[model samples]
Target: MEPIKISGILSIILGLIFIIFPVFSSGVVSIIIGISLFFFGITLILAGFTASNIIIGILAIIFGLLFTFNIDAVSFLLGFQFYIIGIILLLAGIIGLISDTQISKIASVLIIIMGIISFALGGFSIGNPLYAAILIGVCLIIQGIGMLLD
Candidate 1:
């Protein structure tokens, strides 16, 4: 098999593992995000004088503190971001549907489906981070399979 195919196969296999054991992945991801946020926040706070926007630096520090100290809040914040993205996608899909183009319609439907999935995942993430992780894992698995086929 070609290198690309081999890479795809490996991606699929890794995705499957993530899907099967999502809690571990979620935990690990959460830790990494928390640490990153914490450090970034510190950086912003320390370098506030250099930032073009003072508010941005302050907000970053606040959010960084929140993510570092409050794991549940971090989860909810991430979920909220996803929900916002879904809402944007949903709007785009609606626009595509209104355009009446055949290809656009198909793309719109797929986008709408993705939007709904993202909305649901956001809700699930707020309720249970493990479920959110599972959703992400499933998405990765699907993408890997698509790549393998291509």
Candidate 2:
């Protein structure tokens, strides 16, 4: 719409592309976060008027270091965190079932159904990606036995 807005959007898009394809910028996104942490950190640490805010700032710096220095580890940790959250949500759904209110019962039922369906679908896809491959192998083995007898 406006020139400034369009410029900002374009910049964001370019930045995202650069981040996604870090080869284009040689991981400059990571470098920037690390550098920002190293500097913003000092400012926060120096402004030690509040302990809680300082702790948050320190955590941010640590996260930045993790992002920059250990991108793969960060991604893995994020995935692990999501898995834990999913399990926690499932447990919460179970607890909601145990204690029936009004809307909670409906939410619990829906959550259970979704969990069942997701489990089934995930099993089907993950467990059978090579269905045709396995079938072909078995058929070939049968044919070989039959030919050997004949």
Candidate 3:
């Protein structure tokens, strides 16, 4: 079998485990999301030129750091941060629309979708990590499958 096919199978299996696991903790979830946001923010900071992109990157970095280093206060702040990020994303999307590049608009749309999801999920009181795990796992599985197809 090809390596990509093996990777896809592994990703699917891992995703299933994360979806089924009951013992995962919130801290783990926080870290997972935090790291992802941190890197994503960095990528945005480097990729875009608009003010909204910079603001969103800064906000993402702040939230990512908070979740990574201080979980105690994150529960209270998560919802607010997510809302703020969502707004920033919307702003960025609007700004991107004004630009001539279709790639910018496409990326902005994806960011907006992610922001909306984050905003909606910010208030969940239970199984936060499980939710993140499942979402990430699904993404990984999809990516792996794409690689295999490629």
Candidate 4:
């Protein structure tokens, strides 16, 4: 019922999908990320709060368009996905640990571990998106469980 629980459920479902159909999920993830970035870029540009924001927004838009339009680029860029996910998870864990958020200490640690694992996997399988998809799925499942527990 809560937002966290809802997120957990969605994460678990997505994780299962990723594990079941790594190839499909990988492509879909790339497209989804592309679309999200596109919209975020649009928002940033519209906001025009600062010059840096506008610059980053333009870059985001360019990359978003590239990712959305080119599947080949997505395949090649898969290696970076792990690093991005790892950094995000690491930051989330650190924030959770520092702040009184819904994420408990244990969950935060788990997230941090997942982040480290993601980085390791990325390093090992820089050119393999299928492996990355499966690993990302496993990490998502663990993160979902952590969220549920929290």
Candidate 5:
């Protein structure tokens, strides 16, 4: 159990590194995801055929077809994934504050602060994404320069 847990943690660390780097092989990730989906769908289709289940077979084929054909949907799905994660965190913090101890109460406070920041960013984005983008870029540049000077 410890070995499996450690392996899972290591996998997540590697995944975060790949995500955070200035450059990443998005195409490679996409290809891997597609392959997994394809295999999963194929397995489902085979199972459906064995059971003479037309609906399951059709769903599998449709999913398989969509995996490659619907790139935009894939992007949307990934974006939605982030949003869902944020919501989950927000919920957890709220729940923890009610049910847990001193540390969790503080965590909720920090989470609330982060949620406010996210809201502000989204509010600014609503008015002008270009302006928000430029502000973010400039902020990053300034921060990078400050870090170097330090």
Candidate 6:
């Protein structure tokens, strides 16, 4: 089979896993992110471009270690992730609203609503992780199908 087709199949399978085992999938993702961050921190420190970089690198390493070694920290960090994503979406919506196009205005309103929901969910520490996992799964499935079609 072609590489794209193989990847498409893999994406679909991963998406199914995400949907079936949302909690496990999220935990795995968190660990992977933590490991990546730990390595990234090491790289930054070794590069030693500037004092600020070193500071940021140290901070990253600390957080990375926490995320890697502590499940509680991972859960906390997941909530924090929602907050970060919410802020980014809110900012994007605001920027989109600044545009003069009609579509932009409509999309911005939706984005703003989603941002508010994400922010509230983060603050409440509710079922956002489960919902996020399911949402991601659906998206991945759609993307995989698209890739196969292409």
Candidate 6: where are CA atoms >4 Å away?
71-74, 82-127
Q: 1 in model 6: Cα distance from truth in Å? A: 0.1
lDDT of 1 by residue, 1-150 (tens): 888788778777877777889877776555554565456445434543433224444554565555446557455565464464466457556655775433358887997897797688788887766777777678777877888889
Task: Please give the lDDT score at residue 99 for candidate 2.
Answer: 51
Clashes of each: 0, 0, 0, 0, 0, 0
Error of 1 at 51 (Å): 7.1
Tell me the lDDT of candidate 2: 0.47
Q: Using alpha carbons, what is the TM-score of model 6?
A: 0.63
TM-score of each: 0.49, 0.34, 0.63, 0.59, 0.39, 0.63
lDDT string, candidate 3, 19-44, tens digits: 66623534565666577668767866
Name the candidate, 3 or 4, with the larger lDDT value: 4
Under the 3 Å rule for N, CA and C atoms, how many clashes does model 4 have? 0
The TM-score ranking, best first, is 3, 6, 4, 1, 5, 2
Clashes by residue pair, model 6: none
Scored against the true structure, residue 76 in model 2 reaches a CA lDDT of 45
Worst 10 residues of 4 by lDDT: 44-53
Q: Please report, in order, the local distance difference test score of every candidate based on alpha carbons.
A: 0.63, 0.47, 0.64, 0.74, 0.45, 0.68
In the range 1-150, model 5's lDDT, one tens digit per residue, is 355455555554544444454133333433443454456446544533433233433543454454445466655443232233234335445644664333357877786566555456555544433333444445555544444444
lDDT value for model 3: 0.64
Q: Pick the candidate with the highest lDDT.
A: 4
Model 5 superposed RMSD (Cα): 13.2
Candidate 4 per-residue lDDT over residues 1-150, each given as its tens digit: 999999998999989999999988878767775776678567656744556556656766776776667657455676676576566557656655776655589987997898898789778557776786788799899999999999
lDDT of 6 by residue, 1-150 (tens): 899998898899999999999988777655665675677567656754555446656766776676667567355577565565465457556655774433358877897898797777566534466766776688789889988999
Whichever of 3 and 6 has more lDDT, that candidate is 6
- Candidate 5 regions exceeding 4 Å error are 1-89, 101-103
| Range of the 10 consecutive residues with the lowest summed lDDT in candidate 1 | 47-56
Lowest-sum lDDT 10-residue window in model 6: 95-104
lDDT of 3 at 144: 68
lDDT of 5 at 144: 44
